[model samples]
Target chain A: MQVNGVEIEDTFAEAFRMVGSRILITACSRQWALQAATTMTGFATSVIGCGCEAGLEREVEPEETPDGRPGTSVLLFAMSKKSLADQLIKRIGQCVMTSPTSACYNFLESSETVLVGGKLRYFGDGYQISKLLGGRRFWRIPVMEGEFLIEESFGVQEAVGGGNFLILGQDLESTLRATERAVAEIGKVRGVITPFPGGIVRSGSKVSSKYKFLRASSNTPYCPTIRSLVDSQLSEAVNCVLEIVIDGLEKTEVGEAMRVGIRAACLPGIVRISAGNYGGALGQYHFYLRDILGGTLG
Target chain B: MDKVILRLKERSNIPVEAEAICPDLFLTKSQQEIEELALYYGNKGRRLGDFFQVQGERSDNIVIEGEIPNFKKIGQGMSRGNIHIQGDVGMHLGALMKGGRILVEGNVSDWLGAEMEGGSIRVKGNAGHLVGAAYRGSSRGMRGGEIIVEGDGGSEVGELMRRGLIVIGGRAGDFVGAFLIAGTIVVLGPVGLRPGAGMKRGTIVAFQEPDLLPTFHYNCLCQLSFLRIYLHHLREEDLNIPQEYLGGFYKRYNGDTLELGKGEILVWAGQVA
Candidate 1:
């Protein structure tokens, strides 16, 4: 199958099952809310190194927020429930609580929960006030600027991570442009986030590395400069490649994101749209490129 | 669900203790069984059928229609269901209610929702003294739940309240939230003297300037995000809240130093101190 003359690989993108949580960060203004959200999601790109994968999901309107303030919605995913809880407490307590005029709330509704503000209340040193309203408990911790309000618990549930598609283009400029367009289209999809810098990962890695200590290494087959020295997957005309990784609260959302992203990335000079996988093993979810574009499961 | 309605047949001068009028009790009883429920009329044993005419029954949804100004403890200790009162009710309405809702279309007398563990009580008319307050000897008042009074409230509202929210859309009488352990009381109109007296840890928000006690110390003038969240909740509850009140800065005053001194009274900075 081809989209805008770009070949759609028959292969599938492998994704692992994980746990995720959504946090709504509201502040005195949109700038402050974004500031806190960006800071909290910083250094969180891949769970292998950062212990979690996080990114800004979207900007929330003032009326949609709990405190009626401009807000930002962020999604974070981890390998286990405990890891997600630990990452939440550390990031929210350090990044959001420290930001001026910011309040954090549990944006997800699920049966399973993790204690967030209930534990962060220690920062108040016995001065924190607990408010139970409409069956939801919130903690008000006194800070230097003012009080930092946060919900007692955040809901967590099973999620899908590492949903991806690789953009193979004729040159660096074409590949980068196509990937940017794909990321912009993916941004409009809900419940998914591209947990990478500018939503584009240039150094897509393989499962194994040459170094014994390193569990994974760069995807040499997709590297344009080292094509002659490695088992390159590119053609004579292809010189650049970029990948967009997605993490979503559900498998269907991940599939939808990949579908939209691939459609947007099929510009001129784009060679093919492919996905990374380990022979359909290791991951629980797989998104078949041609099947997804054909509106059916492979 | 068929509602159990009790309409007053005759206006009684003597106060009737109607603790058995709770929805939890009437939930499984038939109309006849509900009418047979016992009551004390001025220390005299009487049947609920003696004064009020019972209608549909065996439902948690109850509707009481009449000027029951002499009836007390209407929904005392109720765990679940809904009670709708169309006329004025006497004292101790919804006291000790655990879960459910009570809607009073007319005025309610003293001790409304006293020591209620859970549930919600909405009074459209004015309320009598000690609303959501603990009994004279009890250490805690309303442990959980919510009480919203669209009209004025009597003195000592939410006294010794441990938890929950109390919103009075109009003026609150003296000593509002006095001896509060931990809770939130929002009075939209001017508060009476000595609000939050002896409160250990709680919040009393008064839109109008209040006559604060001597022990209270002014903290600072800043915008409280929690208050904004609370006001937004109140708006969802269909209360008429002004745009200014939702975003205005408040003058925080930590007070009742005679006790824990952790309690605070946030007076609206828009109003003159």
Candidate 2:
């Protein structure tokens, strides 16, 4: 299959199960809200190195937030529930708690929950105040800037991580531009995030490496510089490649994101769109490129 | 969705122990069965049929229309469903209620919503003393749920409250939020004397200048973001919150130094400030 002259690979993107949570951080102003969100999600790009993966989901309007202030929604993903909770407690305590006039709330209401403010209330020493409103409990901790209000707990559920697609272009500039467009489009969807810096990954990797210490190595088959030296998957026309990775709250959202991103990446000078996988050996979720593009899976 | 309406046939001078008139009691019984239910008039055990006229079938929704100023325990220990009272109600209107909602269209007597664990109570008129307060020896009061008073409230409102919210739209009498352990009390009107006394941890927000207790020390004056969220929640409950208060700063006083000294009293600074 092809879209806008870009060939669609027949393979699928393999995604592993992850535990994720969404947090809403509202502040005195939009700038402060974005500041806190960016700080909290910073350095969280991949579980392999960062211990977690997170990104800003969207900017929320004043009326949409719990505190009637401009806010931002962020999603954090980890390989296990324990790590997700740990990362959330550390990041929110250091980043959001220090932010001026900021408050945190659980964005999801699932039955499965993780302790957030319930545990962080220890920061207040013996001064923490708990208020129950509308059946939801919030903890108000005294801070230097006045008080920080956060929900007692946050909902957690199984999510899909490592959903990715490669954008192959004739040259570097075209590849970068197409990947940028794809990231911009995927950012519009809810319940998904591109954890990589600027929402694009240049070092697409294969399953394992020759070096015993490395679990993953660069994708040699798609590397243009060594295309002639190895069994290359790229055609002679393809020169540069950039991958856009997606982590979403559900498989359907990941599929939807992939569909939208692939369509947007199929722009001028783009040669093909392919997905990464371990040859169906690992990961429970298989997002077929054709099925996503053909609207067969929701 | 069944609705049972009980209209008053006569004004009972003697207080009636009407604890059996809750939604759970009428949810499964027929009108005749409900009428035959036992009740106490002072010291006499009489059938409910001797008092107000009963109508409708078994339902989770109950309506009581009467001059029932002497009716007690109107919704005691109610776990689920809704009760609408059209006139004055006696003491213990929703004592120890765990769930559901109670809407009082007229005045309510003392101990309204006392020791309530969960559910909501909205009073369209005045409420007597100890609304949402614990009993004299109880450790906690109104652990969860909400109580919104649209009119004046008598003394000791929210005393010893451990959790939940109490919103008084009109004047509040003395000892408001006294000995509050935790939770929030938002008084939209003038507050009486010694508010937040002995409070260990909680928030007392008053629109008018409360009769500040000597134990409270001036903390700071600033805009609180959480107040917006709390007031916004109240607005969702159909409480008429002044728009100016939502955007204005508050004069915070950290008080009850005699206790844990963690509680706060936020007095509205008004639009001019």
Among these predicted structures, which one has the highest DockQ?
A: 1
Q: Count steric clashes of candidate 2.
A: 0
User: Global lDDT of each model?
Assistant: 0.94, 0.92
Note the DockQ of each predicted structure.
0.84, 0.68
Task: Categorize the docking of model 1.
Answer: high
Q: Which stretches of candidate 1 lie over 4 Å from their true place?
A: B271-273
Scored against the native two-chain complex, candidate 1 gets a DockQ of: 0.84
Model 2 Cα lDDT, one tens digit per residue, B101-214 = 999999999999999988999999999999999998999987888899999999999999988889999999999999999889999998998999899888999988877888
Compose the digit string of candidate 2's lDDT tens values, residues A23-133.
Answer: 999998999999999999999999988999999999999989977889999999999989999999999999999998889999987889999999999999977777777
Clashes of each: 1, 0
Per-residue lDDT of model 1, residues B1-273, tens digit only: 689888889988899999999988998999999999999999999999998899997899999888998899999999999999999999999999999999999999999999999999999999999999999899899999999999999999999999999999999999999999998999998899899999999999988889899999998988878899999999999999898887888999997999999999998887323
Please state the error at residue A287 of candidate 1 in Å. 1.1
